[model samples]
Target: MKFYCSIHEIKKTKTVLVGVPYDGTSTYRPGSRFAPQAIREASYGIESYSPYQDKDLRDIRFYDIGDIPLSYGDKELNLKLIEAFIIKLIMKGKKTLALGGEHLITYPLIKAYAKKYKEFAIVQLDAHSDLIDSYRGESLSHATVMRRCSEIVGFENLYQLGIRSMVEEDKLLPHRDVNMGLFDLSKAEEFLKRIGDKPIYLTVDLDVLDPSIFPGTGTPEPGGITYKEILSFLKLLRQKKIIGADVVELSPHYDPTGVSSVVAASIVREILLIMGN
Candidate 1:
């Protein structure tokens, strides 16, 4: 969570972003919380020119608020800090695109966003459904983020994509109405065939991609989606309004070729292109 919110003085910029790098309760690989720093460092390697967004996008002024004050030792305080910071950003009329520490951070974040935009929806890209009640008895852990998001933000507007892994707890979570289409990447094309359209807020955990492409996430399950298919689904999004989005859970240490962060950075670029002027 080192530098997702970068502030640069470009005349046409209209967005304000932040990095929330606090992954305190992750049950598996323990380093995704450090992904924000790696993503920012990788940003220095990108060309400031855009192929989809007009070149003016590179000329936009934005702020990098670095990492927010995280309460690693106190879970309750972590929630408070995230909730307040998100609300503060939106109240300033600046659109926020967060770089995540872990998927768990999304719940508290939505609590703040929902204050002003009640109809907010999520377009999650992940392998696991993340509908657990708790992980090791930790209700707020990353494993239960979707459960929490449903509780705080309301389930009527959420749409989950790329969900293949399933926990027994998730079956009992009562998510029948979440409008989810769960499938392995082998079936990704067919899956999208049935669900043709909708508004979306993209939340991607690198684990959603096959480990061969990004092996640096906290949890890397087999049979994840392919990079080509993921982008294809994004391309299929037609006439839909995307309000805000996030790319979370990339642990750089395990990325043998530094591919994960580059993927994350490139996804951000694509969002800029798709949401173009």
Candidate 2:
């Protein structure tokens, strides 16, 4: 299914919603591959308009290209496929709004964007630092996605927020980016303002939401930010230039109540408006 209220075809759109439906690298729980369809199915429950932004999806001409049919076993091939797809959109000068299979998908997405835009930034919202060099002897797992991304975009251009969970190794990582915890949010607007009009690839790991507000991810960290707080963060981001973005790591089955999917869909709607505007 397409996103709730997408209005344009792929070739004729400013923003394209491409779903990366491969969860091959998930270590904790393995259902995020189902997230794209789950979020799309749940989008119908919400309206196309956002009172917060006073904008409607009907005002924009973004396209939802549905999920990429990635292979199950070959993760290298899957990531390459994601890169190829994103390159096509970039070549067409279209910004991408990707629904991800897992955070690892961000690695490929950024790799593709890096080829087109130099000195662009990466803004990550997550519970974990994802700064590990590798997880389980594998460098390409979801746990090391940001590390891989930093290699492409550089740690100087990476900004992380809402990080409360991390391993001892994560803290010891010398190349960690400027990470902002819950308390640091008060200064977020200033930090984002310094970024100015730099092109940014925004990636949100839904687990950044507290388990109480969003419990459908593989790793649900406690003491996370609220949905309203996330909206505030997004609002600050509206002034910046967002070239591409992804909402990832929502394992719908984890929350049988389906509230998580609804939240994901709503965030997608808001992000789409931000990118379109």
Name the candidate that leads on TM-score. 2
Per-residue lDDT tens digits for candidate 2, residues 99-135, read 9888999999998998899789888899888888878
C-alpha RMSD of candidate 2: 2.0
Report the Cα RMSD per candidate: 3.8, 2.0
Q: Measured by C-alpha RMSD in angstroms, how accurate is candidate 1?
A: 3.8
Model 1 misplaced regions, further than 4 Å: 1-13, 50-56, 59-61, 168-178, 184-200, 236-239, 275-277
Q: Which candidate's lDDT is highest?
A: 2
Q: How many backbone overlaps does candidate 2 show?
A: 0
* Local accuracy of candidate 1 as per-residue lDDT tens digits, 75-142: 78988998898888777765667788888888877787778775656667888888877778888888
Give the worst 10-residue stretch by lDDT in candidate 1: 1-10
